[model samples]
Target: MLFPVALLGVVLAAVAHEGHVHDATPDTVPETEFQSWVAKYGKQEDLPFSGPLSFSHLPYAKCLEEPDAKFSVAVLGMPFDTTTSYRPGARFGPFGIRAGSRRQRPGRGYVLHYGFNPYVSGKTILDCGDVPISPVHNGLALDQMEVAYADLLRRPIANEEIDRTRSLALDGVEHPRIVTLGGDHTIVLPILRALHGIYGPVTVIHFDAHLDTWPAPPGIPAPYEAAEITHGTFFTSAYKEGLLTNSSIHAGIRCKFTGMEDLEHDVEMGFALITTDDIDDVGVEGIIKKIRDRVGSGPVYLSLDIDVLDPAFAPATGTPEAGGYTTREVKRILRGLIGLNFVGFDIVEVAPAYDTNAETTATVAADIVHEFISMLLFEPKEKTAESDFRVQAGRNGDEL
Candidate 1:
């Protein structure tokens, strides 16, 4: 059975081995080349999936035909949104983001594995499916999440995360990379919980409208309580729980939801605040440099709450700020951090219900994912040129 090498979750590269799999663009290359590459790398013993490989046909969920890793990235969709204020549809964010991410220009979308072609490179990514959730049952969801993630966290790989550094390795797959598509900022807590347990005291790059540093505030009636373990209270708990390196370096904060005490507590707790006003003063390049300087060479987990995109760009978030970076600017800032010690990122708070035009939030989130993969995966100038071309949108910066 053949698999669709769509994204880089689990790849299907064209090797010169018999019985290997291959995915090639229609009419782009001669059909003979596909078979040739397969003959080289497609060994029957090295296949990722076998025996009536089912579920590999699902749009967002698929099993690899041959379980081998070439720097994998697991993109888990955690669409559970039990705690939200003023917005209730972010549970749809992950699906919306995936739906909008199907971009394949005339030539592109493959480089990391199979030089400038997806089929040749294989999809170097994996969809971990949605994190087990209970949309209607909060406690149950948390319980299920605790149990499920406890299983993940308990894996011996979590103990040596950086050494392994790929979800495939953690999941006992070959050495593959991992990227998480989040349902909310709170999802970062569990990821950090898993990561921190192994690579203790990693620095966090937080991009959001609010500080999210409030201790468990009183539970509010609608959406969420300021203090619940929902989206809003996640960071506070993380700091207390010691997930972040004391929750340091929060960028793109335009609005303040927590009191000054919490704010001050966050600061004393080692959280560095980067205001929208400051970002405005310094360009994204400068801001990224500042963040890199502060963080130095720590293991980085980027947490991007889409509300930072000023309501004009990302209005679907529960907490939208008036003045913030344009989506382009946010991409630029993140671009500068490319090649830095970045582990993974979560673009949270995209409530599709708020956006009458689904493109508004989905596009932002998808673009974020694209730019992230572009920065994290794509190799440098000459290599990228020789590699497959996806979109011609001119991305300039460091590359491996």
Candidate 2:
């Protein structure tokens, strides 16, 4: 039995030999040249997706184990969900996100307004595959993830020349930015540790329904408290460790809290809260301004919990909140943050088992990441020719 033509294209692209990929100017080429290039280039073996399964059919490699290839944006999957408080299936979030992104292959849906296909943005992006973790040991799992992320972030940025002999140390080399497909909200804790090793404490823009800053009850000892290192307590732990700055803020917070102190404790931890109701009060523009004003000009880490979307829009997350932002609203808000100093990002808590036939949840997660990569590669004032004939509306800074 043959796979769907699209899936077959992805499989071939992944296992293809290196050095056969084309650097085409899709927007600038003549019609006859573009058609010839597509037909001939379709058979080339050296292309993106060098591994068996890559996100959005991009190149795939284990950067930590093999340093031969160079990359600028590395996508790593964290497939551990041991610490989830409400549901347990987010261990499969990475797979679901990757599967949903397959539709973006053959450059079909690259947003024209963004002015670039991330795959062809003259930057190297590789799917570094998923990190290995022991399900039985949360502490050990956390340690392994932190170590893996640190190794990836310390890698030197890829240049035109492929230098296989270069050391993978920070050693005055610029590091690649990372976009992680998360197992759960808890995964952000280890990611914070790894990023702090390089960029120091970062300002976080956390989008979630729950605060995730709830502290463990008092009177617990060391070993006992270790058990409290869960999804709900990660932000509190992060604040205590000084991995995040006072400029950190939470958006789409509508979860039930114990009382006024929960909000006060979060404020003391350096977070400004934006409830679901705020979406109506401030509108998307006002919300965008608030985010910019809060994050300022610091290295920013964006952690998006899928539950930030209303259950109507995304019902496949572990904790489905009823009142939350719609997918369109969230996308518009994210687009507004373009050009900010972003170091890393993650969209967590997608559990495909709970999804509808439309696969609404996983598709939204993939779309969010697509916009993220586009934002990462965005440049101001570069205009594509009118005869470029790309699909979709042209995006300007204020148009969206």
Candidate 3:
């Protein structure tokens, strides 16, 4: 009788547990409710902090890998810094700049100054990813950059509505413009070589604390030919190769020099100087006049070294100078040159290992790149082959 009573109690407890489990399970939603749930949460937006990394969260494509890919502008990275003279970590600059652009997105890409969103300007823009660079060999890395840049430069433009009159296409066929995230200042030498192939010599507007035109010293000899291609001497090499025109100019220059002969040689290599002190003397408008008057309307390439900013504003560059232009001044100057035909652009020498907790250096670099995108997509209402009213209009209070 006792065993039978214990069995009956166990059965009752098992039935009670099963009943509780059945009551706790949720019922499936009706078909209409299921569709509403899918509509709310099916697709994920490209949020700043949650999506795959790309510049401003633009679409990513391997331009080198896909021959048929179409884009009007591309952001290419050259992660080669084997030729840097001082710092060793600028090879990581491309990744740092991308990370610093986390707060920017295509939906919020409106520029208050320019009053347009480049992402929606009827142009296909892509982050074409980085060129594969050899870390151990400088010669191979330089060749890799040159070949990669030339290939990308020759790709057909995706937009049929591109105004050819405002562009630098020597042939009637439209070509894509590239903004390179650099490895070091030395990367410009190969880039100039590639541009020379298509556009002949181009006018360069160099913004740097250093002249970057130094040649090998009179007595010393390089152990190898590639050893002569340091970041400090690339402009001289470009000059030797005839990759520059006489209209090129330099701004924010305040680097230490051996003598006045450095300025003389810089002039011979086709550059006029605007020192950091000149900003205080001539003011921002005066500097804008100087750059616009010098570059005129031509195929121009702009190269900006991160050291052009005061170390207070940007301290993570490979070389830092004490006094330089403020970030606002640089942006103003860039805005003032809106009508010039820009064929290419670059910002280099950001060494993230030396950056601050706020990542000021890389963030500034990314902002300047944002400015580049706006500058490219801008179209003037009244543009002519002989006159640059667009630039004069920007200098005044007119929208571009």
Off by over 4 Å in 2: 1-51, 159-173, 218-221, 382-400
Candidate 3: tens digits of C-alpha lDDT, residues 86-164: 8778888888889888888888888766666888998999999999999999999999999999999888888865544
Q: Quote the lDDT for 375 in model 1.
A: 53
Shift in Å, residue 5, candidate 1: 60
Worst 10 residues of 3 by lDDT: 391-400
What is the per-residue lDDT of model 2 for residues 94-163, given as tens digits with 9 covering 90 to 100? 9988877766553553564665576776778888888998889998999999999888887767743221
What is candidate 1's lDDT per residue for 199-236, written digit by digit as tens? Answer: 56678888888877766656457655333787876777
Best by TM-score: 3
> Which ranking of candidates, highest TM-score first?
3, 2, 1
Candidate 3: stretches off by over 4 Å: 1-38, 41-44, 161-168, 217-223, 381-400
* Residue pairs with clashing backbones, model 3: none
- In order, the Cα lDDT scores of the candidates are 0.61, 0.80, 0.86
What residue runs in model 1 are displaced by over 4 Å at the alpha carbon?
1-71, 104-107, 110-123, 146-176, 218-227, 257-259, 380-400
